[model samples]
Target: MPKRKADSVLEGVPKLPRDSSIAHHTQADYIEVNSFVTATPCDHCLDSGVPCMIDRSRRYSKCASCTRASRVCKREFYTGREWDLLRRAEDKLSSDIEKNEDELDLLEPELSALQSRLTELY
Candidate 1:
């Protein structure tokens, strides 16, 4: 990500160092759905001293509070396995669409043949 020139200029201004104690935890939606939360670092990228809060959920071990602290600490982060699962789902959907198309094509000809036979009988 590119920082705007105006934002870059602000860095020249003298500023007090951040106080890390008051930072809160954060959550990552992408990670939490697939993996269990552990005593990972805070998800939120705070000043540095913030600690992650604990979550006991079986699906998501970490709470939203920690998600805010650090991206690396996010409990809900996805692994390679989740990405593989997504790819598999997309493949299955594509296969199903192809199968339905084939079925439709077969049915259309059968329907036309049946109509023609009825007309001849009449």
Candidate 2:
């Protein structure tokens, strides 16, 4: 028995012509897969009392540590200045709420009196 030529074995296969249009495409033609990742670790790491060593190459919201721990990853972390501002805002809101509660307490009796008067009028 004689060995078959490689060309004869591939003779049954249909060949497609090289696409010149594909060669014309540049890098810009392809969609970028990697997203912009932040260097900072997620809130879970901070809350867990662990160092936030984020692996930016993964391009995931959760860091590798957090992912392994099966925890939710939150990116929001306040700086010292932001925390101070937030505390001030919270104090103001609490004062406003107390004032509103006092005003509501004062108005409750007056409202009851008005409702009683309306009932008598009707």
The prediction achieving the highest lDDT against the true structure is 2
In candidate 1, what are the lDDT values of residues 1-122, reduced to their tens digit?
32887777787687753544223321344334434433334446233545444444444444444444443444445557887999999999999999999999999999999999999999
Provide the lDDT at 15 for model 2.
73
Where is model 1 poorest over a 10-residue stretch in terms of lDDT? 21-30
* Candidate 2 per-residue C-alpha lDDT over 1-122 given as tens digits, one digit per residue, 9 for 90 to 100: 32678777778688753454332222112212332334444777566666554443554445545545545667766677888999999999999999999999999999999999999999
RMSD of each: 11.8, 12.1
- Candidate 2 — which residues are off by over 4 angstroms? 1-34, 37-59, 63-76
**Distance from true position, residue 59, model 1, in Å?**
16
User: Given candidate 2, what's the lDDT at residue 77?
Assistant: 61
**Global Cα lDDT for candidate 2:** 0.60
Provide the clash count, candidate 2. Answer: 0
